[model samples]
Target: MYNKSHAQMPMDRSPPFSSSSSDSSQFSSTSSSPAKSMRVVLSIECLKGSSKADEWTGDMLQTGDIVEELRIGNMIVKSPFKNGKSGIQKILHGSFKQKETSIRVRVRRGCADLAELQACIVPGDQFVGRKQYVLRAIDDPNYAVGFIDRTESQCLDLQASRTSRMVSALERTPLQDGYVSYPWERRLVEMLSIPNSSSFYSVLFLPKSSDKASARYNDLEDTLARAHTWINASQASGVPIVFMNIQTESLLTKISGDTASSTVNAGSLSDLSNIANTSLYGFEDYHGVDLGVVRAVRLWFSPLAGEIPIEIRIKDTDTRLGFAISRTPEGFIYISSVIEGADDVPSARSGLSSLYKQASQSARLLVVSRISNQKLLPWMVSATGAIRCFDTVSLSQKLSLHRHTRVPILVHVYLWDRSANNANVGSIRARAMSTSPPTPPSTEAHLKMTARGVEEGEEDSDEEETVASDGQEDITIERDTAGEFSFRLHDFALKNNWV
Candidate 1:
């Protein structure tokens, strides 16, 4: 009869078995008696110094450890195979060729306790499971018996694989489980994965779609087309575009503990009353819980319009800047008025008059997108859907300091495009108004501004005054003795109501 007690004996007493040099000899010795169990187990000869060994095995495997079973994913190859060591080698080679990420080996170490070994054994099955046994090499001093921990690299690989599978499933069926989805193309994904590529992109989520004829649906199509065009054009100019989507609920959960479920109950009645109101609080709610969507697409691309970057140097003799600044309701800071015929001022020297003239002739606004290399454009959107921008008061102070210090300022302006016919500006303003909440009177008073420096009581009565065209408003700042304007641009804007 097979001696079960002998098989369970401590491995330290037995002579070292070298499977690499004499697999056949070891198998023959074990198979000598027909009544005895012939288990052809493999042992670790030595581990290679490769990174794969450290990442996949580390100290879990050691020299002279008995490998009872090998597992690759769901497939398990146990000891006592048909061809002994050669069979296990063939299986391992096949797994390597298949590029399997997970490879687990159930090993029995010399110091493993007899009680622990017996406890690890399966009740019904003869073969031991991969996670059942713990190696003494791993839990030496502590002697705690549990499943081996996965390496960091291995954990990351598993997570990446899971995410990939989930994304693939999402791409297959976008609309699933009351969630709208948009999958990024593989090319866009690759582009975005490149280092520092995130800053080049921006995302905007649209409301949920129920009707194809609805304006929301049309807007979505238009936005997609525009983004596509921008990306294509940017790519042509050697700039790669990044387009991506993320789950709104997941984002909200991470940022704030609020889930889509709570908002869903709040908006349920309203959603039932008006099918058009797909969101819990309409489109103005940027939190995105009301959209009932898993993913929304956002695109980032290089500048599409011909943005002219102008460098204006403040000379010692210059007093008046020769231009007025104002912002549109859509958060565009623009040259509202220019002191005509001023030759020595910084604005005229920088050729702002010519650009202003072109803009006037084309019925377009001379918009300043950036000042002193810092972007002055609307940089963020509030939860209430208001366009959040750089405070003009602070910007005026910065400009005033620059003038006092005679520091040069760089500005980026969007030149008037005859082909576009101011359509871009008009569309942006219309879109902002459609989704944005009405600006409170107090807030409007604080933000709106038109600023120009003029001599005391130098009113031009003959200059047919129009608000959009160099018209004198309620607030006027007199030029100081040094010729620098001393009033805050936002203060002027508040009094004039020039938003």
Candidate 2:
């Protein structure tokens, strides 16, 4: 039944080249002129048969025939392929998955002869699978037509390129720009430049081998020591340091059967390091394609130069935290205002008073990095350069509860150094100033409170009196105004909280 289907396989009737037999004679006659190069084509070298070579009978395919094109099912691939033998093997592998019965091949009898022959290849005892056909490129001695070998029942032996091996290693690693450094050597992969700054982020790869019990312990110690060095260097230079460790495995196989696909395995240190200078730096497989097995351990180091860590312990009698918190458009939380002359408040006693005075005089901001041991700074950046941070509303509510319960709050504030050339400071100041909201006009009640002290119990009575005065002013303004009546009405409503 299979033989009948194979025999009925469709073939292309049109020839790839001219059918005129006098073409070779015309080429020999033109030899007196400039010699032209012949187009390269594939040829059948040797076939593996049962006993000796060329044992198969009734087969239309013969040795030394130039392959014109190959067709599997509805898909057809012409000659002079870019990837050569590898490209053909890939097509065969895909066809195997589709369970294709046969493939049609068009070939030329000889270079001097223009006769085209078509043949159908099917699975049998001699050629058990599609991968059994091994093709290789060969140089033509005549320099007229180069030949690429097409054989059956042979294995393909080819080495993967260095870039391919590096790409494979990077895919196996769990983190971007990470590779396993085997044999206990610390190697720098690449240095990524930071925008608007002279400093750079260094990428390094460390290896973790579990072959021996002592090797694991040694790797751990080395990682810790390297982390300490990075942290210290970053602190001393007032910069940030980040590193990730990639753990790689050995001996990974992706072949489902005797034929292997184009999947590359990890290689030696030289092979993996060769990609550092290429354009593949910082390459990541965002699609989650399977390459190999690997593990990642990440470490982050933040600058500690101008950071001030303060712990504020609230007392039972303290009515407020004595500090107002506001967020910039850039999603940074900062101390917008501080209550003055309140020596008994928690903020006054926690040394925030000095910091606030210094910040006010210097016209700088007190950017809060952490509150109550919770980090409030931006932890991630999106592709559009937008920062991700904790919500300010929830943080303010938590701080209000802490003040009501007299709980201590630990805060980490970043102070910008005026003498230093800090790009972050300049960026923050520019963005804050550009996106700052216009200040609202002060109310008459607030002015009165500032002039004469009003107790907490008298606040409601003062508000009632202010509302009555505002109503009388609104009525008087309406009677006296004519052309500017609409503006007066809007101003009255804003002042009396009618809006």
Off by over 4 Å in 1: 1-250, 254-304, 420-499
Per model, state how many residue pairs clash. Answer: 2, 0
lDDT string, candidate 1, 83-199, tens digits:
655565456555555765244444543223111121111111122233232222222222112222332233223323433533554476333266666655665556552322232
Q: Write the per-residue lDDT of candidate 2 for residues 279-323, one digit (tens) a residue.
A: 111211433234432222233323323466789998887766666
Q: Name the candidate that leads on lDDT.
A: 1
Cα distance off (Å), candidate 1, residue 421: 9.1
Error of 2 at 261 (Å): 23
